[model samples]
Target: MIINFSNLMFITLNIMSTLYMISANCWINCFLAMEINLFFFIPMIFSPNLFNMEMIMKYFIIQVTSSIMILLCILYYKNFIFNLILIILMNFCLLMKLGSVPFHYWYIEISNIISWKMFFMLSTWQKLGPMMILLYNFNEYIMIFSIIMNSTIGMLGGLNQISLKKIMSFSSINHLSWIIASSMISEIMMMIYIFTYTMMMFFIMMKFEQMNLINIFQLFFFKKKMMIMISFFIYFMSLGGLPPLMGFIPKWLTINKLMENKFILVSVILIMSSLINLYYYFKIVYYMNLNKNYKINFFIEYNFKFSFYLFNYLIMTNLSYLLIYMFYY
Candidate 1:
């Protein structure tokens, strides 16, 4: 156990060094970073929780395959083809990491088994380190592939999902695509995308915890129709990229930047994909309002519709202003 823990610690340090190297934008250094990120998850497979063996095995194989690709790309420095192949392979692994289909098998399984907080870390931070390396090394082409992968899978897979965890996983995938989209354009879009995604996700997971609601289907039991409707509308609308919400900020920037860069086809595809996403988002809205099957017993001690009162005004105000700032920005 000590040996395994030490090895994991060492691999994590290697990953950190690689991230720093890539952030400097040196090509060879970036390749090293990719290789390190690919290999660092190996020891995670040896974890004793012993719950997700199959998923861990799959993740291990995928990471090793991706790492081998990166190493080969490094060996043949002159061949851009290897570099491209390496990028695509690593991108494929990241898609799998982020739980986007058609590589989404491990996503649901591991998430189902892991603690929510660990699941949150896996979905958010673990992906970020590798993603930062990708952006630093090969932003444009890699980002295009990421955007297509994320938008296509997220919107289509998330349709009609009732499981809250699964839905949040797909939502994470979509927002990740948004981050990839922003990365292609400029540094500022990337920054804003990261910040907004973090804040949005913080609210989502917390709200999920507060409601003690297991699935999106149970969201109707949240009690206060007045506030539930409002909060749910804000959340879904933000997800839908509706006006003045914080969610629109990234999309607004993405579309403008893409048009400016003359990537019209990809831009159009993404916009239409957002529409596909909205189709499902509205379904939640429909159920939240029109569902007469739910018992509306109000919780006297804690209202899940709004957050704790100390944060109540502050959270609501900022959320509403996402709409305002969407227009303003």
Candidate 2:
């Protein structure tokens, strides 16, 4: 009971912090909200493992450094002549908070040491405060540079990674670029992208935890399970933003918005990078399907349990929401 109550408290505080950041009218308020968020979330991820200790410390140091920089920027944000420099400084600080490139090294490194649950928080909920604050003073040139670097680096970074955690970390960065792009067009689109991403990420992280998989090679063991492979295929494809999937909708809308706004170059880069991202996702799927020596049976066994159905239900829910979104707009 005590543990549950503590968790509930932390969760409530975390949500409140994000709300504060979103509703903040000034830079100081945003900074305070971010700090509250950072402090509240730290205790949730606490564990006895030595790696967790290392990861927590690293995370703490990075967040503090960014927070301090953000505070300093707010203090010196008076001169119009140095407005551009201040904008760059503030955006860089928030990007560091969001784990966007080129300040993404700490984000990727710490991902390898944390549990799936922690990583989920790191990639999804933890991003909301910083992202909302980033919009407070939007910088177009820096955003474009971030989009280009994040997409390209995320794709190339994931291609050579064997650890699922690191791959997802890079993928998270890639998705961050999309979120940033959506923010450039419409905050509503950014929220939509985030909602879909959080849903997909939760499901994927759950699947990984259920299977106890850390590396891509472990996926080979599930080759005989047709349902598992099919589900994984669906997840990866959606994540890669393939056509007719829920994930593709946001990207399509964002790219369309970009083109409508005359950001043709950004749209083109996003498309090409998405294709490359899909290549890696498909490569992983290919590994799941690879079995030359064994005669694979398509439906030897069906693990039609609650979790399996729940996963399907989640996918259907996303598609249903997409349908509604499309119908409305």
Candidate 3:
């Protein structure tokens, strides 16, 4: 139950990085903040026996390469034609940092090797700075391509994966498409997407951590807990952007705005890819429900405090659309 010094340091540095990002007045400042954020997170991955050195090395190399590319873009911003090229390169670097589509290989590889806490940060918080930067200076055509690639790749990537972490990585990529699309429409919509996505992922990661569940097959261990299974069904369905759930609100708003702006084709693509992602979500729930006849006593009981928290979280997630409507309208 004791806290480690590295954990404490990571928290402090993460906060500082976020604050710097929020208050950044120039590209240089934002880049430095991102560097600090990456440096701090590297230490969090440093477990003596459990950590994967190869994954750490790959992450470091990719991120550092992107950082250097960003710096070069900033340095050579004066020329007219070269500036245009640099801007495109900058967007690529940011997209790479966000682990979107074609640049997501490192992310999937690293996610499989990291601890759940680090995975939570990587999947959620680590996206904030780069995404914010992308929103500010994004190219319209590039963004459209990114949206298509992210949605298509994310949906296809998770189809054959048994590892829960790999599945979640693809889910993150899928959600990244929606988030990027939202940003193209409105800042408020983008913020809403980020918040909902973070909350849903946090809850899912917490449940997985508690159960020590890392593979889709391991979900069978909790087959007796109907309440937990139902909660997970709702959670994953919401994440897949099903209607009347917390996750759909941002997507609904985004599609409305896109259509208003005459982006009918993009909206259709988004819908189709989301349906593909939902197929996998339902697959996970089907697997969980399949072993219901097994009467093994492997079900773990939650403590009173966690049980109360889980109940509230379930209720809140299920009814979250009402809250969103009340706030927005």
Best by TM-score: 3
Task: For candidate 2, write residues 1-329 as lDDT tens digits.
Answer: 13588888998999998898899898788888889998998888877888778888988999999899889888888844688898898999889989899889989988887778878988999998888888778789999999989988988899898899998999999999999999998778888899889988987888888887899887777535555666778888888888777788888889988999999988888898888889889988888877643464755555667466556756734557666477538
Q: What lDDT does model 2 reach?
A: 0.84
Write down the worst ten-residue block by lDDT for model 2.
292-301
Q: Which segments of candidate 3 are over 4 A away from where they belong? A: 49-51, 293-323, 326-329
Off by over 4 Å in 2: 1-3, 79-81, 222-224, 291-319
In model 2, pairs of residues that clash are: none
TM-score winner between candidates 2 and 3: 3
Residue 98 error, candidate 3, Å = 0.9
| Candidate 2 similarity to native, TM-score | 0.90
Query: Per lDDT, what order, best first?
Result: 2, 3, 1
**Model 1: CA > 4 A from native:** 1-51, 78-102, 139-145, 221-229, 290-329
All candidates: CA RMSD (Å): 5.7, 3.0, 3.2
| Tens-digit per-residue lDDT, 184-219, candidate 1 | 776667767676666656665666666765676675
Give the higher-lDDT candidate: 1 or 3.
3
